[model samples]
Target: MKKRVKQPTADVPALDDDGPFAGDRQFVGALYRGLEILRCFRPTDGPLGNQELSQRCGLPKPTVSRLTYTLSKLGYLVYLEDSGKYRIGVPVLGLGYACLGGLRIRDTAQPYMDELARHAGSGVLVGLGGRDDLSMIYVACARASSVVSLQLDVGSRISLARSSMGRAYLAGADEAERTSLLQQIRAKVGEEHWPRHEEEILRAIEQVRTRGFCTNIGEWQTEVNSVAVPLRTPRHEMPALAFNCGGPAYLLSRERLEQDLGPRLAEMARKIQTFGST
Candidate 1:
């Protein structure tokens, strides 16, 4: 077995406590910190130690140790003896699955998304995603391209400021939420690169307003092209969601996305939202 290499425990920024609820007296800091520890594990991460968790979460190692111990005992994290690290436990998976299961739109939208993808052509993929902090996490997926499609699945995440799906979501979000998310994105990207991302995001919002869909052609990835539309959730409190049809640039030309798939995806969103509300 390949030996696990632990990342250096320096230079990681601490968790920002500037959220809207930071000043709320009712907010449980310990509970929030524990959840933040869970959020640090991404789809591609390996088991993490207290040192890494401390750096990632901006918590002291001792705090992380206590949190990890509590989480491990609670079955939210599993400690590994060999690596001296923790991986997300089965109970967390159960919670995720339970959340997904409650989103009725996933079932109501899949058939329509699949049909739309087929009409878009081979190599194309259809995805339904919702905001996950600074990213959009796919909650449902469909593909028409049997042989080759974007290497994404239900749990894959894409950049919220770059992806068409995420931009559509931004367009659909309430003004306050959108402003907060943009501020977070600006902080993440830094002042040096914020202007370009801001421009692209603004343009996407305009496209959605005028044309009912947004396109990301060779922007998020140099060779990928996609079109997306905002989707309405059944409840107001739910996070904003979007649907995207995308694939390799060579297979999905800008004209085709703009003139064909984009409108169809928007129509699909309309129908699904109608069904979802009832």
Candidate 2:
């Protein structure tokens, strides 16, 4: 007798769900599928063929072909004829840089991030979440030591479903906004991998809400840990930004993080938030 193999299931939710953009049929489905294709590229996959993309996105080969063609035509992706693969295109980089230029949060928070890095002897990052999206843009960073380096840089984009900074912001978001963002992330990354750390993530968010800070242990990057605190403007309607300090686990132990570094980060967040008012 042969052993059975469990087939993988579609991880995304049904488009008919009464969440996010509830009744917008064609627009939502196409948008979701297109984003699914682009997300197939990762830090590792240098470039990928239509076949690989199809397999990864769980879309038909013809659909992947059409989507890639449209993306190439729109300048969001480029095709390599010889190798028959595709990679992120130049226009996206230009747009990303342009967006970074417009964000003033980085300028306001740089000094605070620098102070945190200096005092804590760790790398610090300040980021702002996209208003209607489940992603965060790293606006500022200050590195204290050369031993540990986070691959992320200023202007780097990270998913809200997987990052401490993103989660802290989301945890602070209003009920309706948080639900919408969660729906979008699930629609994009699917349920399986998207919810890999659901319980832990929820707990982390609650802790952030309760303690006014958030900590992540080997969640986003293996062997690396981080702590973050939210920065809110005077109105306190949304988290205007967030700041975090991170490094190798050896240097970012829970005891030091809670006792020593947490207060410094909280103080920095307050100063950044206050500065944003002026």
lDDT of 1 by residue, 1-278 (tens): 32333343545333344434787777667787889999889888999888899898788776677778889999999988777899999999899899898887899999998898778778899999998888899999988757888999988889999999999999999899999999999999999999999999999999999999999999999999999999876676555699999999999999999999998999999999898878
Runs in model 2 with CA error above 4 Å? 1-22, 25-32, 122-137, 155-162, 180-198, 219-222, 234-240
Model 1 spans > 4 angstroms off: 1-20
Clashing pairs in 2: none
Clashing pairs for model 1 are: none
What would the per-residue lDDT of candidate 2 be over residues 1-278, giving only the tens digit for each residue? Answer: 22111233365344344333667664566667777887777655688887899899787666677778778889888888767788998887787677667766667777766767777664443334443255676666787766556767665677576777777777767689778777777778777866665676687778787777788888878887777776667654334566677777877888877777777787777777776777
The TM-score of candidate 1 is: 0.89
Candidate 2 achieves a global lDDT of 0.70
